[model samples]
Target: MAFAVTSSTAIRSSLSTPLEQPKAAQVGAFQPSDRHHLPPAAVNFSRRRCAVKPLNAEPKRNDSIVPSAATFFASEVVEKIDVEDYGKLAKDLGNASPLEIMDKALEKFGNDIAIAFSGAEDVALIEYASLTGRPFRVFSLDTGRLNPETYRFFDEVEKHYKIRIEYMFPDASEVQDLVRNKGLFSFYEDGHQECCRVRKVRPLRRALKGLRAWITGQRKDQSPGTRSEVPVVQVDPVFEGLDGGIGSLVKWNPVANVKGTDVWSFLRAMNVPVNWLHAKGYISIGCEPCTRAVLPGQHEREGRWWWEDAKAKECGLHKGNIKEQNSNGGVHANATVQEADLFNTNCVVNLSRPGIENLLKLKSRNEPWLVVLYAPWCRFCQGMEQSYVEVAEKLTGSGVKIAKFRADGEEKPFAQQELQLGSFPTILFFPKNSSRPVKLSI
Candidate 1:
């Protein structure tokens, strides 16, 4: 909702340079733009290009209860809200309340986490913390190009709270040079994402570093695209690298359970810091240049980048992250392997002691055994290790046994014979009577 500016030098060292440009068709082939100042070694050749998606889809089902102006502020959680549901939404704020949701969220998340305060829902969060006698860290991204109103709110919040808000600014010199050459509004004419790359997205990646978990103002009533079932606490892959490669372990959205009218009621009741622009009917806020007023029937996100093609409403944050992470060629972060009996035929068992009776054991036991070949070093393989271990444990009580074979390093002869049969993390299911195994690639 808002960006905070801080001293520049510290900002530069704290941030990882963003990827150069979007990737083309070739897998694992991408050029790093001069957007951020990432080192060459950290370039991550395996990182794939991420595609951006619009934010105006029906809010994720998980966010169905988010209060919005269109809903007339009802707090009811509808079971089947669709794009058409917007037309039938109530405009009153009787049931949908922000304060009630904040109370519930605080009780659940505790003081161990912070929220993504961008000055929009930020006012409510700040006031709620003060009123409830709960102290929490206030964090926000400082994209060098923030609106003046947001800064005023920042100062006001600090004065009211008697605490310094953590300011996450962009690299000073990098922003200066990029803005100088490209011009301040280049992103408006060319692509807003480019501007976001240099400001919001990259800076956010840096600011999120070292946080154990965080809270966001995201709600379901905002868009159809986010309407999926929302989870109170979930792993956010976007910030996975925040703390030494593996990022924040948890993300909480307490407002995910709250809707719109509730926010205004609390603001009035608590006399929270209200933004001047909101008085002019701006329900949501972002960069002033890119954001506009939403008409009565328009989607909540219709105001964002209104000049762009309707289908291209979103900036680079959400879309790019999902695209790059889903692709097989992309960096492996979240991976899971599920194994099941591929064939009806009973499989043979193969038993052997590492040092002795290899041939004799194989000859004596007619049934073949299932073996999972994996490399511990491979990131993808690492994700599957737990699943394989679970299978090994499950099969222990049953007559079927599971065997683990390292694809590389040790047991060269055995590795070459069974483990080396395919790429790392490959599963081989051998039938009860057959010597040959079926390769399972997931």
Candidate 2:
């Protein structure tokens, strides 16, 4: 018999108050929500209803179906799938709504399919999956550097959805090794690829080791240059798994055709818990150190690794390859140096070795200046470019010179030694006649 699943009742019935919020002590102290003061808005869900036949009620057919992992006693046999079949299926469902695509996926893969929840689009996927009244799995990559608000949103999602989210973390030893050798923020000096590989890619690989298929919230419009051809379903070329063995896995992008506005509309309409940072202009959320809110009229990708070119926006999680062409003839060989002279100028100056002497002369005049040490490849720095420029324009009359230095280029040593930089896009305030520079919080 077909069952009617009202979104409100289904969500309310499934959601019981979490016994306790998950502790994030190892990462950082992030309070999810106060027990007495949990905002109703965060948990409010849409009342829209739909009808779906439960998998158990449907007649058993020849289609290969993996039993839910929750049924531990069931057979652990892996299902063999033809790649050609999924390619055809992707084409058929290419124009389907996100919910319809999700329903088809859950029916086929059962618990073997898992949602790779990042923040926005993933949550919308979860809302649709939950409405189906079928058991499914969800996982997230807890890159050690996620914002505290992201952690809070994670908890809120769990409490509202009534599901346990498997958070995959980088191996402790691997993280320790990377941090020990390269320092806390090595991505600023060498580029973000290496750090992302250690913190995000490896952990995600481990997480997908057991799943047969995975889903993401990638949209074609998000990165037209890189993700323009994203299909609703395709074989993941990079990672492997299906029944916990090494093999190509089905990858689903149910919302690939949906716009960002549509995702936000669903979130608001469904009252799905979302990362609070979104309200502050952070469209695409990732590691705290790497992400920032974009200015008005900026693209979402700009909020991510902004220092890189448009085609290189991916962090090897989706696209799988992180290698960049070393075609520069080693011009960036001194890229690792951390000490250099700062340039002085009246207006917004791009500081470098040639201008260092002039900067010193300006320093002697006792004028306060705001200096930004940034990497050209850092996405966060790129997102803040317009705002910083505006700040400089406004401060021009106050005798305050806004200046910047490229830490990833010729002035790397200057940023490393003089700034004592820990992360990319470091900003400092030098007061008149003071030998010390106060690090300004971004």
Candidate 3:
């Protein structure tokens, strides 16, 4: 039977039932009767600090799809995805739906790839993978400091899924050394990076080394400053997999384009068991000491490392998101002008050359656009990124569409000729009536 967290509301309300191992039968890995006998998620939750969002009160298992269980027990050896084509593949799957992306990753890598499940909403990865009816593996980090609710939720997931989750933990010696020297809460004084490297990143590194690829639940909306450019697929720039080296590991972010609200919607609609912490305003739940509840109007990530810079909150897990500011104290894009944009934000519309032209063509449709033509590497453009995003955020309910267009590299000539782009950062206002875009002085 297909086993994924996103497919059922049959959470074992009580921890009384012994964890049952997958029962291999004549047909496949498990008997359909095995699921029918399990308990439902009727546990009484304590009142929360914040208003609790009710789970799918009805059982979703009745409608849940169960594919070939035979695919669940054993995995056949499959050819690994070619890491060299990750760039091209990324563009190809950039707009693919989350289920489509998950299916491709599971089908290509099979058991060689593992779904990285945090005790949080990432369980949706497993939910989608199981729908593909392919054999897949899963792993998670035991930071040893997670919330009690998280651990209980992990056990509940394992029990309900009828599968084992390979758990990784930080090296005992390394953890002891750090604790013995720095005491228990040094992150508050120094930073969270070092502690996270020991508890989370290192353990993850060890886990990835055993697989050819891994699937993450990362969405572009998670950490806008760091993850805004996250593609659906890519070659892992930091961690290596089974073959052991850079470019050996392929990374699949099945939900790269999915929104946070939509993820919860999927989980709820499917009747998936969610961590109890989410109801307490802990939108970005992590290790207890380092994580707190997010206040009203705050981003989910603000709960993590609240003392640190919003842009530099990554815990070394995804090194690609790490940024090093240039001497001018502005973001310095990479060598490529187009791929490297002046700023990263989900608020503004990032239009390609063709997209800009298409917007211009829609003038008769009464659509307005405030497009910024800028070079990614220009200091002035980089400096204005903050203000630009602020404007976009403020004008969200307004009719104006704030956008960015890279007016550098091969596209520079086209931008200058058609859009009247003359400077490093040119603001062009396209009104509803006229097709001609008027240049604005900013």
Against the true structure, whose TM-score is highest? Answer: 3
- Model 3 residue 116 CA deviation (Å) reads 0.9
Root-mean-square deviation (CA) per prediction: 21.2, 20.5, 21.3
Question: Model 3: what TM-score?
Answer: 0.59
TM-score, cand. 2 vs. native: 0.56
Model 2, 72-116: lDDT tens digits are 111122233323566688889988999998877766665567888
What lDDT does the true structure give each of the candidates? 0.46, 0.60, 0.66
Candidate 3, superposed: residue stretches over 4 Å from native: 1-71, 74-84, 322-442
lDDT of 1: 0.46
Give the per-residue lDDT digits (tens) of candidate 3, residues 1-442. 0001111121110123333334322212322221111121111111111111222222122111221111244334344233247778889888788889988887676555688888889988877877676666667788998888888888877665655566778889879977998999998987786688779876777677655678888888997656777778877665656554455567899998999999999988877667778878888778989888898989999999999867657776765533445557555321112233443544589898788888777746345667888875554464345456556655665666778988887999998789897886788877766767888776
Candidate 1 deviant stretches above 4 angstroms: 1-112, 227-229, 241-243, 316-442
Superior candidate under TM-score, 1 versus 3: 3
